[model samples]
Target: MAEHPAYPVGLRLTGRRVVVLGGGQVAQRRLPALIAAGADIILVSPEVTPSVQAMADAGEITWHQRPYEEGDLADAWYALIATGDTEANTRASAEAERNRVWCVRSDDADEATAWTPATGHSEGVTVAVLTTDARGRDPRHTAAIRDAVVEGLRDGTLVAPHHRTRTPGVALVGGGPGDPDLITVRGRRLLAEADVVIADRLGPRDLLAELPPHVEVIDAAKIPYGRFMAQEAINNALIEHAKQGKSVVRLKGGDPYVFGRGMEELQALAEVGIPCTVVPGISSSISVPSAAGIPVTHRGVAHEFTVVSGHVAPDDERSLVDWPALARLTGTLVILMGVDKIGKIAEALVAHGKPADTPVALVQEGTTAAQRRVDATLATVAETVRTEDVKPPAVIVIGEVVKVGPTATAPRE
Candidate 1:
């Protein structure tokens, strides 16, 4: 009779010994997942990639630092023999077999007793896909299927059995710059559970398209034009929705605390005795410049980086910023909501003692498909802004750190 198929089961590898008999690309790819699983990983190899070596140095894993010995699998519950040397892989596999431990062969999967599946996780659900044909199965095909399942789970096309309860409360979720993929896993999971999403114009809008048809979407920008009224109305909407026993997600771009007025909303909810949760997002102040290939801070270039709101012009009486002190300080200055007042802001900075030739970068719609960069010096940035017609929702970076990193651009004369 034919043998039964390999029964699928989840392994609780927390604190369990997992022996990896290689330190090449295969090991590098597998180590991270194993680390996430809380495995007690012991890597046996003569040399390792820089990243794997860093992991060992950080005490995340143990490095054997030599060829695999026959008895290395003594107490290993699982083993992966992926050494480039055929003889070493053979020895490791044989030792695992002698100890009755499940062995996965990276070099010769056909001879192995176990196979790694294409895996992904969404909303606490782990999906693992394995092909029946061991000899010539396409990994990319399996991976694509895994990705489709994950996307479905994330976008609410597929639902998990243990989905989060649609609690009647507010979640202030930071959408993370502009990239849909940049959002936190918890934020995505909470979004899937949202019955009403009060969204900002700058938040990841692509995700909204994936929401279930039953979900209510409110636009913060459409709530009357005066800034104070608009924010007050948004706060009212959150309380109103949650009071009606509906789950509300206040989806904002970047971080809620980074000039997002998240605390104000929380305080409003608290006044009504409504419990709220805040899931922080990747702030655009740093991510946007990085997307344009600029680091906000660099070693010896700028020790400190300051992010300021340019919504109010420096000369405005309501503005509390010390422009002269800012100009005198020597570090990176990142300005948000400053595109409309770039000319005045630039002039003020230069007048106060900031060098006219300080490099500046204007990253528009950063981390998105339409991301564009305009490079200039502080003296000429105003003109560059006018010439390029740079729009709002852009990040303005000023400092020598702009000259460092991969995407550094030459300043315009």
Candidate 2:
């Protein structure tokens, strides 16, 4: 036998018979890729791992529930010999060779007619890598290479200009909390593909620095009570850039729909017949509390949790929140954009029958390096904010659930 370089080729096994001679870990791993390829999979084994049996139960594959036979490869376009039984695997491999079918042996790669390459997919591109040498094979090294290539492609570090197919549209991507790594994969990929990114000050700011130099980065910072970009103007920017045949990504902090005015932008885009993609993000309402070791709902403590915007005072005519109704409920209340009105909000809750001694936590800049938690009673929360010098972009958690987590023992301000 001569050692030679292996020729790599993709198999179009859709609707073709693929016989798997085992039901153990190896079969468990290979069955998914086979099923994903639309292959008609047949598993011949008396016993199978729970995961492999699940595939049979789901009708994803046919289970023979018996040992492999000589004629098992009669109609198989491909065979995977991974029963882990020396005699059985050898017998199956010989049968596959006799039938002139491509076979992969889990126990002996040298005897296998085909090898599975380390594979990955990114942006509609499939990468397959195989390292073959006289010194033998290194599957782990091959997989590492595959991962590096896929990650580089995803983060816009390694440019494959010829593979790009630009599509002009508006993507309302939720940047997720305040961490760059927390953004959704689709959102990050769209950001990499963006020609113009209209970013909010709240989202993963670090990600913007990674964008290609050719990309246009616009500051749409909506600072509270400060210089901000108007909502209408932001919408116009999206419409104008998209109309000019450019991909526009409106990156927002937290979830776009959660008090982020994402719907306003979407509706504005819709009016002009511009296509829009809404990628939901992790809202600060819940994530911020969690980051500070506070569970919004704890067993036997809070059965329901409500998220409210505190941007408007309860006494304001523009306010829509039912502060009285909220006070009546026994569940946890998570407040966003309420730092400025914490005193008024605390007063309203107490006046509406909510206990003045109800536990309160303000997690500032949650999930970021500057994150800090301040504790106080509902009655003292206003003074606590003033004394602690808490600022905007903090999540105010109210109710007994705040006292149920690790932050329960935190010193009150």
Candidate 3:
């Protein structure tokens, strides 16, 4: 059994100058979290994404448009080094120590001064597991066992936001690709014990059915590519729910942190002295591809996979997608929310480098009985989907694996 983090050092990072040395989605994901924790964040990265620039422009954070400088760590209470580049992250972690500031290395948790546990929170209690250990599963064995246990709990117990606090926890549950059953068992248990469930409107409803008849279910669901929920509003709700001394389960579709605005909520909960933990769910970005018999990473056919939302922005002006290069790439491309952009996305792929006959499949409601896969190609996918009336909440996968029909059952070994 892994030893629990003794004394569980929970530091208050509020109002502290925290320098984050990477400003892409990883940092964007981390920034809202730190800000919610009340950190006066200074983001330093040579390159920044539109999200980072927007956050910087909004005065939600301070931006330093250069690589990490030795002086950047000065006076900073804490430092997070999450640059996707491994070398830069290592150097930043080292630099933070030279400045005598506490540091957390985002790329390598074990290398940090304090490793952030994969958390499960509700009520007032946060269960930080270095890794959940149900006795004996050595390393690799342990991880699988922990995941199984966690998944089982999500699907079975973590649904209700109950009045319990002593064993308080929050399930950062992945509602699972719009399919309720895809949610893990541990997620269900957390829901069952919830006193408040702050959920995305698009998350699966069947999963919510697991909650006891009277459990409080709060719908914080955001409309698709529409009037996005003000982050502050959702933040306030999480704190308010947890402050009620009730277990709040943020039942989001897919993994809460994976494009689910979960980090924002967690930071808010942390600021108010309410512990926050996450229960991860399968991201449809890849899950949908898998359910449709597409291996995101197939040996020679495709070695890399990129998942970008086709709905990051409704109009095409500021969206930064290199359709030309993406079309020619020999890797799987999975897109979410491109029902409207399906025609354009497919055309772009064909116009660039993909074969007109390249296999494309649209898997809707993956991992559930209602799951449906519509197979086509770069040339015909758009029209095929349109004619079939496939709707949003569908994941589009383009790769050779689609031709394999991965949905077929495997023969017993």
Candidate 4:
């Protein structure tokens, strides 16, 4: 018999019975999609993989916990025959055929009534690819095609302006430490969809270059104690652009909630009744230290890690951090925005209880090509920063975990 071209159509199986003949790897892969389709799934197998068992435990599916019966396909809108038992799968496939239920056979697609396509989703659109030839089908090739289409849609390389629905609002996107690739997929997609991007100086700077010429890029860099854009002005700018019917993205370095003053921006937008979407990014507090080969927490070295903002001096009334309490802790202490006040911070820590010789490391411009690590003890960190001319936008790590990694043995600048 000559092979005929398969007609492709999506099945609406919500609240309908779908029989799964196996509980092994093949069933494990197919069940989630079935559940997602809102199918009332039935699994007939004596045993199942741990992950499949988890789904059953979670009340996501019904488990028969027995061998396939002759009438297992009864009332099933669709069937998947993936039992490792050859005879059982063949029998199940025959039952599906007699009942006219579309079946997918894991062992033999040629004999099955239906073939699952390689499917992907991007921004409310689903991309499904199926390829067949005289010899057989290439599942991997089909998946690759599906991936390419989905990626293109996600990054704005493929655009159907007529098909897309544009909503004017603000998205608080965290661009991650510094690398453009480090940005989250959702954050990058929002950037691709944005009409106006108000960005910080620290996050993924290179991503701005990739934007189309129509995109308006605003420099909202709030450099500490330098030429800066005021917070009030930035808030007004977001409100102004969004009111003009444009999609605005406030892209900040690291996670927005982590000392990024993201809440203030959100509250300001909330007062005017403009909706905002927050996409979290990898915080530099933990990532910067890791990039420089320092683990904030280590087994038998440090049990806990505390992240503190050192923008204010320990002696300053505006400072909220308890220097005495922090100095007494045995775990790692990661400080941000402390370059200018490192001397006072060091003095307060030592004067309270922290040993002067505690190991410390500062990772400057972390996760970028210009990344560098400076090492010193608590006693000498102030003078070290002075002699080394260390700048802002660096993570300062204090504790024994700094001395645990391989960088501890490496030469210091």
Candidate 5:
């Protein structure tokens, strides 16, 4: 009779010896999950990637610093054969079989006794996918399913829990750069469980519509600037709502501390003895330019990138930024909230000795379906902005890196 299929089980490998008989890319990819599972990993390899070496330096894993030997799997409960050599992997698997230990061979999964499932975690729940057929398991199929499940969890389409305890508290969740998919798993989970969502104009607005009907959605901009409620009033609103035992989520765009005034709100909440939690989001300064296919710091094009707020013009008395210093640097300059002041900003940079022809890219509504890019130079960006009618909430990238992309050419009118 044919043998039964491989039993799928979640191994409780905490503090257990898990021998990894390689230190190549496969091992590098699998080590993180092994570490997360609390396994005492012993990596046997003559050389490892810098990341694996760093992990060893940090005491997260032990490196044998040599090729696989006959007794490598002696005490190992599990083994991973990922060496570049197929023969080495086969020998390691044989040793694991001799020791009655299951072995996962990255080089030839079908020849091994175990397979690593595509895995993801959300809000304390771990999802693992393993696809097996007459031939063997398909990693691509398993990973696709895993990604779909995690995507559903992040977007709230996958129903887990609508109500977590209604304990009075505040969670400062960074909603990531515009894309709802980019938000952290913790941030998304908290958003689903919030009793009141105080949201920003630039955050993941699509997520607000997904909240349960019972969850109150507060437009932060309307609550304060639109309705004449000051920052103090907004803070009071949080304190008052939480005092009534409601969970308040301050969902802001990008990272809360990246010129988002998240600390100001945190301080306000602290003065009233309200406990707050901050979940960092992906900053647009970096992600936005990336979405437009612009690298803020490229290997030889640019070495450093500076992120600054452009709400105030460089010539304004209230402006705190040193325009001359910024102009002197031959690096990338990322400006947020600067569309309105583009004319004056560009002039100041050029006047301050930034190359008049320095390339600039304006990414509007970056990382979203409506994202658009307008390219120009420091000398012509003002006219380009006018020509394109680029609005606020756009990221302005300035530097030589802008001219290094595949399609980058002379500035367009």
Candidate 6:
């Protein structure tokens, strides 16, 4: 395949309608980057996987659950044929041409619109190394090695562009609510000096811009509500990035410790040759609530606070958080990802002991300008959420915390 001389052009997938044609782990691996690139993606497959389902549910992607049909390609701007079934992908490719939609054949060697290049970026500068791959080598393996090699070359060419890596202390920086500038001054300073930045997707574009252009940004695999790439992979990525004689910043949104899986990664690093340290952050767990003017800890209405994940599996074989305990527990109860199970959670709390009228507020896309909140009670928060169009990336606050301010002050539940 001849490389388009303009191939390296920075491609912004923003607002384009993209169709992904697979639903398995491979499809999962391909989804986030496209979503991260801001493409409006729709997955077309008979059997959709959980990650894809969640993205669809969160309204991040449009999920077509039925089997692929001929006309599915009609209005797409670009299409990605990722169905493991090569025949389906091939057929989709053909359909793409018929509809005049630009498409990438996930399986074929020479038939498609754009080949996904090995990608890496710093600040707003994006770099992609296109593989001529004429020998028909495995593109995935080749891309991985190419990315690593590029990093080695980048290390030597960089100076002040990467001073962030040479910083003396770890900055437990909050990447910010959304806009990169919302990040604390301390966070920016640390990011500026971070020799090694281990970032999740939560880190914003501007925060990343603080890094040297050559800095190696490891792309970690995200498995929603499920296990992430083994902690070993993340630990090794950070340790290796640092051992290459660079400083490291283990970055997470809100706070590293707040359900951010910071402890697990830190332990892995500590077990290996690397030592561990922490920089505390402004936890969105509470800050997002405050932004909505609904305090998690109020003066008279609320005091104690308990944070729990809506998705985390019980650690003990015999867990103790039955509805009775939850209902009776004092202070505030903050639940993450409890949206799907909001009904069950509320039901349990009420049935066990809590009042059905207990106030509950569900906040999503928290702190960003797009934030939405649904306020209700132990009995109706879920129903309220269903009717209100609340989405994921949300946090839930139950108990008297809902009454922190004048009822009129915060966005209504």
TM-score of each: 0.79, 0.93, 0.56, 0.94, 0.78, 0.53
**lDDT (tens digit, per residue) of candidate 1 on 1-413:** 01334556788899999999889999999999999989999999999999999999999899999998879999999988889899888887888878899989988876777889999987568999877655547889989999999887876667664465655899999999989889887888788878899999999999998888999999888866575588888999999999999989999999999999999999999999999999999999999999998988888989899999999999999898999999998899999999998888999999999999999999999999999999999899988988888998899999998889788878888
- Candidate 1 deviant stretches above 4 angstroms: 1-4, 46-51, 155-164, 176-189, 224-229, 270-275, 287-304, 339-344, 355-391, 397-413
lDDT by residue (tens digit), candidate 3, 223-308: 22235557777777777767677777888888887778788777777777788778788898887777767688877677898887
Q: What lDDT score belongs to each candidate, Candidate 1 first?
A: 0.89, 0.90, 0.72, 0.90, 0.88, 0.69
Return the top candidate by TM-score. 4
Model 2 lDDT at residue 8 = 87
Better candidate number, 2 or 6, judged by lDDT: 2
Off by over 4 Å in 6: 1-182, 222-229, 313-323, 406-413
Predicted candidate 5 versus true structure: per-residue lDDT over 1-413, tens digit per residue? 01446678999999999999888898889999999999999999999999999989999999999888889898899999999888888888888888899899887777788878889987677898877562655678889999999878865668665465645899999998899888988899888878999888999999998889999998877774544546767787788888889999999999999998889889988888889999999999999999998999999888999999999998899999999999999889999999999889989988888888888999999999999888999888988888889997899999988888775656875
Instruction: Choose 1 or 3, whichever is better by lDDT.
Output: 1
Q: After best superposition, candidate 5 residue 359: deviation in angstroms?
A: 3.5
Q: Model 4, residue 91: displacement in angstroms?
A: 0.8
> Candidate 2: minimum summed lDDT over ten consecutive residues — where?
221-230
Each candidate: RMSD: 4.1, 2.5, 15.0, 2.3, 4.3, 19.5
Tens-digit per-residue lDDT, 1-413, candidate 4: 22677788999999999999989999999899899999999999999999999999999999999999999999999999998899999999999999999999999888888989999888778888887662568888889999999988877677667566677899999999998888888898899889999999987999999988999999986423333557888898899999999999999999999999899999999999999999999999998899899999999999999999999999999999999999999999999999889889999999999999888898899999989899998888998898888898899999999889887743243
The numbered model that scores best in lDDT is 4
Candidate 4 lowest-lDDT run of ten = 221-230
